[model samples]
Target: MMNHSMSAATNVMKTVIYIVCIFFAVLSIFPFWIMFMNATRGTFEIQQNSIAFFPSTHLISNFKILTGKSFNPLVGFMNSMLISSGATFCAVYFSSLTAFALVAYSWKMRQPFFTFIMAVLMIPAQVSGIGFYQFMYRIGWTNSLWPLILPAIASPAVVFFMRQYLLATLSLDVVNSARIDGSGEFATFNRIILPIMKPAMATQAIFSFVFSWNELFRPLILLTDNEKYTMPIMVSLLRGDIYKTEYGSVYLGLSLTVLPLFIIYFLLSKYIIEGVALGSIKE
Candidate 1:
């Protein structure tokens, strides 16, 4: 009966793993439940009683208070949209361009150039924050959205990720064949390889969008004007005395800010994760 014992042991292990997974899932969902409950209760209602589980009824009122006339949450959302989209578009295009150039070229110093790019990728974003701020300020771009837009045109993370994927996926024979077929360099990239790089591009686009959308420190420092405030900025503005702090409104604002990211992840998360995993695994 050793075989029977072994099967029983395997079943026990499987059951244990499944139970552990369920526990973790519940743990992860607990915060989201709390946030939703908080969003659906008045700032004072929560203080009055200990109500747990699904929220009662206060989402619409909370949203109204959070999106007040003075704050104009919609304006903030629009600003974030413009900035994030601009940054994502620029970052993806240039990263792809850099990847293609590094892969297709055969210069004497190609290896060294690539090594430098890789080195840049290793540096943290904060390391360059001071320099970037100063550079923007000196150029009279500090108060405008252009500073945010300009910095994203050259993303080291995008370049490195794209380079790794291109080295794996892109074929030299395709480039040579394109050249032989009277396709110009620009035409070859624009027409041929770009479509194939969709997985990587989509991944980068989602990343850049999220990064820009959630960015607070840079925008806080650079964008001093209230008119150009992004979602993060607007979220930060929800602060006051202990009693005056609108926790319900804050929760509503948080949920509103999170909706776009949720949409993006919902749409592209599977392919993005697959692309990254495949690229890393093969490498």
Candidate 2:
């Protein structure tokens, strides 16, 4: 009788937890759904109705308005893709490499170096924006994507995450074995360490990519040429006069901007979930 009662209570608890999770999931997705719905509405309808759950038939019209004379979404999309892709690649690969070196190799300054990196992680990038922009301007890279892409190679946050992940998953014995087998350091990192770090890499890659794609302030300050503007910058420029703002067009651009992030998440979400689950289990 006692076991049966305990089992019943456990089931009830599980059901309640499931209900709460579903409720929060719906709440999270509701805003995105409304944004998408509003993309298919006219400026007047969007202003009048404000909140809508159902999609309208004005999607084509909204797209027309969005891509009309002044804006070229294709250029923005391509620029964002290039910058985000380069930044994500640099952040993931270099961070993992730095983490591997710190974890696998013994050196005198390793702890101090790691401590310095952590200190850097606490300092926001915006703190050095003036110096960074001045340096970029002096180098004549103000309108170039290199200024945006190159500094990501030293991402302290990614280094921290990669180091933590290596601490949990990487084994020194494997490194020793590879060295004993005459494997080069770079070869071992590329062939052995990287494959083991796939889940963590994917997780960080998604975050880095999304962050680079959505970043606006740096691009706004650096990019004077319209052709060099990223998606977020272009989207920001959609704001017209207060009385004549095109709400539908703005929402349409937003919806389009969100699409690539969705695709990236969909491609890597399984790895993200697996990485989180495995980390939890390990802990």
The estimated TM-scores of all candidates read 0.89, 0.84
Candidate 1 lands at a TM-score of 0.89
> C-alpha displacement of 192 in model 2, angstroms?
2.1
lDDT of 1 by residue, 36-124 (tens): 78888887887776356878688888878776634567888899999999999999988898889988889898889778876786676
For model 1, state the Cα shift of residue 144 in Å: 1.3
Which 10-residue span in candidate 2 carries the lowest summed lDDT? 274-283
TM-score of 2: 0.84
Best by TM-score: 1
Error of 2 at 205 (Å): 0.9
- C-alpha lDDT of residue 258 in model 2: 79
